[model samples]
Target: MLAANIRTQLEAYLQKLEQPIELAASLDDGAKSAELRELLREIASLSPKITLREDGADARKPSFTVGAAGQAARVAFAGIPMGHEFTSLVLALLQAGGYPPKVDAATIEQIRNLKGELRFETFISLSCHNCPDVVQALNLMAVLNPGVTSTMIDGALFQGEVESRKIMAVPTVFVNGEAFGQGRMTLEEILAKVDTGAAAREAEKIGAKEAFDVLVVGGGPAGAAAAIYAARKGIRTGVVAERFGGQVLDTMGIENLISIPQTDGPKLARALEAHVAEYEVDVMNLQRAEALEPAGDDGLARVKLAGGATLKARTVILATGARWREMNVPGEREYRGAGVAYCPHCDGPLFKGKRVAVIGGGNSGVEAAIDLAGVVAHVTLLEFDGKLRADAVLQAKLKSLPNVSVIVNAQTTEVTGDGGKMSGLVFKDRVSGEEKQLELEGVFVQIGLLPNTDWLKGTVALSPRGEIEVDARGQTSVPGVFAAGDATTTPYKQIVIAMGEGAKASLSAFDHLIRSSAPAAQPEKLAA
Candidate 1:
């Protein structure tokens, strides 16, 4: 069950265990159960402080609990926690064995102070890169607080539960048997949801912060680069991000990042965060900028957050990146997380052996179809154009898939669902002037991206497509304000391009700060 190199590494990791821990497994007479037994045995043999007990009676068979010996287990796994979740399993074992977590002291105390007996179950796919964050977060919470319990359930292994609960997305979280959230969620975001007063307290603390020399909004590659460049100049740099990683978190394989031969989105996002942390940049995560105010008489721009906090800066670089563009057809929003998903890499396993449609014939759509072909029964790729826009190599690979069908000149009309979950997709045959419907269980939208500039509609000068308009120097129409990355009018929305744009925008903002000499405007002179 375990490779030799992996076993050696596991043994090294287990040496960090400070207390005795038990793996209480409840399994039946199945192949998966046998595999789990062998894996547990191999794990137990690595550490003297570890033990395995198979006489368990968990409601979910083939599951195991990890906790200190003689104590009630609070962390469990209902399936093999390998693939992207391998790190999650390692952390769970270490934390259960009295090893400290990487979370901050305040967050640890907050988790321990939670009052209710909250049980969290996270449904995940082994192939999903985003599931580990949620799984590790909940597992840590359970380890810290005796009142909390978290279980990571593999959706592919537990097909019955996935179908019965109508789960069509990865990282779908349920608390005490009710839906809590879906998609990639950070640990702070989860805490904010359960702790009602957390948002208000955070807003108050942020509102009282001092003004910055450079304030970069968004935390994607562009925002991170801008922050790094500004901080390197010895200016007080600050970054306010809604999620920090932006669209990169949803990406999977990446072979064209320049210099680096290959890397995934989540891995690159982590590297970006770590690189930015090396500087003296004040990063405030999970904060959305609602409105931007141009430089007033004080020569300081103001950014108002959704949480009622206002951040002031001498120059503001808007790097708020783009999001997955939706079809905007009927029933799409109604059944977004329920059979309508944007990420095939994350949600494809949930639709195993089911019929699904991939909207658009671009590179993303074709790639998604090719990837889903192995897991799903069939895939219908729809394109609005007469031919596919993907590269020749991708289109050839897509055509080679037997379970995939490509339909050109097809416009997605409406997504049909059965109120609770999606059932089919409606499209129009452009050439024949006829309408058609494909009976499917899932619809993956992969058209493109829409810039996150809705809030700057009236405040900043935007193109017709809603992207921020900027000059060659990354300077926006508003003085002392700049924009970069996918949110601006920069062509080619690639990670490498976004970083270059960000560095340019930060330099432009710095230049604007040093050249301008103006007095603070009166209260009456400000825009309403």
Candidate 2:
């Protein structure tokens, strides 16, 4: 809080310098060097307060040895800090630079009366640029209470270190340096990592960010509904819509979006988007969050992203929508986010007036064909069966579309594309047994989408297909990270169902947020 240790000045310094030549276009050689040194100087100034009182500075196995006042500092996080996490990086550096923020005096008073040692060591990789926020949040938590110290280690830099400790994800945290209590955690959730419930209760204090109480992941109906309710409660709220409208966006027409007579994916997604935006909730489109970890127990949970940006919240609701089943073909892997897209609604706009193909013969396929017909110059609907398996109405509707071509009894043998994006597909006729090729601009693989849980890394239980395993209340096997939507073992992957699941999960997150602060959970920080 000292004027010399002002965090804002250090933040501004970090904002300007970072191997500047690569970030900025033109810079004189000497100027760049001067900037780099200045940044390093600022970095060096951050007090090297070791987390958990490590023993030596070898960087080889973190030990509990005593050392001189200055040394290389460690940073930690349990989530990929991609999207909005960029802000957290400066804060973490400031905390490392011996300048803890000038928060309310009451907050510091709480830190001074701590009883035992508490350490939050976050494991992250630079590629997971989003890990910094989680790291910074933990740092803030540490400064709030002197008893707690945080350290961050690059997961890749210390592969052996993380492996020996059994880390499956890039950004993971180990409170008190213990191997137990795994999974992404929020600030309040991390406080549960301690042994004594009483001290944690004493540590309880409301934070500004908690007003956006819970972060509902996924932009599906469930996620949207959760955001609405949380916001309605005057609890701050936000929704990370990786795929806005969940499976709904891929839908052709929804007779099922609550009281609506009929709705299309784009129409429904737009409506939901507008509805959620009506609230003060922060609706971040085109963003993703990889993992969850403890930010601090200041009653506000810090959510980390893939790019190293982070946000603080009272709780989080994971509605991270689902994706279609990938054919896993040769080019499919290379051209994933390229010409190969999953949502017809999201990527469909990109393919306006271009040739495209829709894989799958089910309701989704028929729906995609009908939907793409309006956007693309031509749409080739491929189905393995001789007849359309979708409802008669949809089949007639798809057939009615002039530019849409339904290829019954045909399957895609190969997705041939150039460099990285899709150009066309090689198909085989099932009845005539003839191979054919079709030129196209994009391929919307709507065959079927699995939950987007592959990155979850088995930290929590998953279905046979690798979807996150969740109990009835949206609780995963892990304590802090919750799952919802098609990612769980939920029955139907419909818009209505996914939305319901998202809302349910949000409620569950709220319940956990309330329970995590109970006295029984406040374990002694000295526990092994």
Candidate 3:
């Protein structure tokens, strides 16, 4: 149940309910069901507008639905929505009670105008920080649209269902009984997937926009900094990103951010977004850049998008950041969501009581092994190097775990699976040229990161490793076009470094703009 302070907060929040809400429970004689009943009772006691009923028809026991009184419930939870999902429960209650959500008006109208019925079931682990976004997004859609229904199912609580579906990742979403997507996704991304013509519409709208003074090609720490800095200079700034937070959303704990003692990825990402919002930067989320063109004779650089949209700007900053490096072994891609995972903190709970392997011997790998050892039955860490490259303290902690075993000089050959899910993997002993196999239910890859600069291959100067070549001032080989963050030749891939580089790139772009002989062109204003 909730603590004393949380109860007080919940009581205050319930005051915002504009309509009476009902909590219908489908329960069994299990301990989880008892706990859920207590939680429901506590919630019902907080507000006069709330009612709890034990009679329910859901096939999944220990489940419940929240909706406006006398209305068909569209939002349900098959497990106790605690931990990261606690906020999701609160939001579901409020939204179901006719309390308006914090989404933009355009998005609200789009959800309401959706065509067909959508039944969404999201499987998640309570410990996963990324799960709440997916859960809350679906809940919002269900609340806004009568044709949509969403269910948040705890994979750990429903072990049989998870195993039967061969789900090995948190936040795996199923729509209409078929796999929809897996991983951290925003509401816009989900809408894009379901709305077939959305991309074309967005592309047309974006193509009609005027050129920006400074265009940031990412929305991570670097791109956020660039946008803020450019906007502060009274320039028309814009940001295009696949996701607003980039890889930082997938990150778990971030303790090394200066001045702040501790914070997590999602928390930090939200802060970054809020900070950027303080300026006049136009942030276009869920937009991917496909290609980059240097400044033409008209004094503007062009960035093409995968959705057929092209944006022109006086200056462009490439801060696309990086992504997790995957093991190139066979079956890795096929069983990615089923058994092969990259984020240990997000997917570790799904492999509880099952044997797993952590690939790599670096800090991330050792750290993953140490974390997985606490939840999994056993952890086998395979390192391609001759010795562990983790910090001394991390190595010490990893060595202390009895259930974790380390294998140095081992290269992952192939991820062995049962055609549907991963059952094990094969590795080669580099020293002896011998092959070894270990039976495991999950494989957590923690090798390293690959720069997200594949699109800029021949467009910009790049290093041998595919990183954009940037000078001291963050200026790339092309004039008026700069690069920053993990996608560039930055020595360190730290968040702090990326922010500084972004600022520098923006300043350099501004300098380039001022030094040009051509006069600044007045942008065409569009009707709002």
- Candidates in order, TM-scores: namely 0.97, 0.48, 0.97
Q: Best candidate per lDDT, number?
A: 1
Task: Give lDDT for model 3.
Answer: 0.92
Which stretch of 10 consecutive residues in model 1 shows the poorest summed lDDT? 519-528
Candidate 2 per-residue lDDT, tens place, 382-495, comes to: 888788799999988987899988888887888787664678888889888899999886887877777776656645677787777788988877665566777778777777
Candidate 2 backbone overlaps, count: 65
lDDT of 3 by residue, 1-528 (tens): 789999999999999999999999999999999999999999999999999999998989899999999999999999999999999999999999888899889999999999898999999999999999999999999999999999999999999999888888989999999999999888999999998989889999999888988999999999999998888777788999999988899888899999998999998999999999998888888889999988888888899999899999989999999998988879999899889999888899999999999998999999999989999999999999899999999999998899999999999999988789999999999999999999999999999999999998888989998999999999989998998899988898999999999999998887777677432433222101
- The lDDT-based order of candidates, best leading, equals 1, 3, 2
Can you give the lDDT of residue 8 in candidate 2? 57
Per-residue alpha-carbon lDDT of candidate 1 for residues 297-316, written as tens digits (9 for 90 to 100): 77779999999999999889
Q: lDDT of all the models against the reference?
A: 0.92, 0.60, 0.92
What is the alpha-carbon lDDT for the whole of candidate 2? 0.60
Residue 459's lDDT in candidate 2: 54
Off by over 4 Å in 1: 517-528
**What lDDT would candidate 1 get against the real structure?**
0.92
